[model samples]
Target: FADLKRDRHDDETINTVFRSVHSIKGGAGAFGHERLQHFSHHYETLLDLIRNGTLPLSEPLIDLIVAAFDTLADHVI
Candidate 1:
């Protein structure tokens, strides 16, 4: 998340973030944590858009991603 905050437009960071969230989503699904899996699915979708150049990186989008990370972290804990 810190890396994303620092470089929201960086492809490498975006891919890393996507993979992290994807892993979380997969684990959540495997563990039958439906809510976490759902949230991460949507979050991953957004990252996918960014990665595919369908969505432009903006301050608001970055903020949203950061906030989602917080939510996901809370779920993990």
Candidate 2:
């Protein structure tokens, strides 16, 4: 994850990160963690923006979403 952050100029890395967030959102919703669901949904929306090229996948954006994943995991557990 850290390596990806350092080299986010690579399209593949960004897409891989987006897919990971998407999977977490699905699992979080499946486990019925409303907070995780909410957070992941919001986080996914942000990723969608990047995936669609509507928004640039900047370092701060990546960092924020990565942190959101931790929060989602905490809520799930």
Candidate 3:
């Protein structure tokens, strides 16, 4: 995900990162991790915005997502 913040418009980077989070969210929900599911839901929403182009991919946005990912990861662990 560090690679995402480095490039503002790397489409592959965007898709890959979004998929990673979405998959994590889905897996967490399936495993009954409510805290992770809740946190990931918000992250997934942001990723959906980016994936759908509703939110333009930018350094700041990616940085924010990365920070959110850190928080989510902490909770999951």
Q: What would the TM-scores of all predictions be? A: 0.90, 0.71, 0.78
What's the candidate order when arranged by decreasing TM-score?
Answer: 1, 3, 2
**Candidate 1 lDDT tens digits, 1-77:** 67667773468888988999999999999999999999999999999999999998887899998898889989897
Between candidates 1 and 2, name the one with more favorable TM-score: 1
> Which prediction has the highest lDDT against the true structure?
1
Local distance difference test, each candidate: 0.90, 0.74, 0.79
TM-score of 2: 0.71
Which tens-of-lDDT digit does each residue in 1-77 have in candidate 2?
Answer: 67656763566666786787778778877888677667778887887787789997667877886787687667656
| Pairs of colliding residues, candidate 2 | none
Off by over 4 Å in 2: none
Order of all candidates by lDDT, from best down to worst? 1, 3, 2
Candidates 2 and 3 compared by TM-score, better number: 3
For model 1, the stretches where C-alpha displacement exceeds 4 angstroms are 6-9
How much is the lDDT of residue 21 in candidate 1? Answer: 97
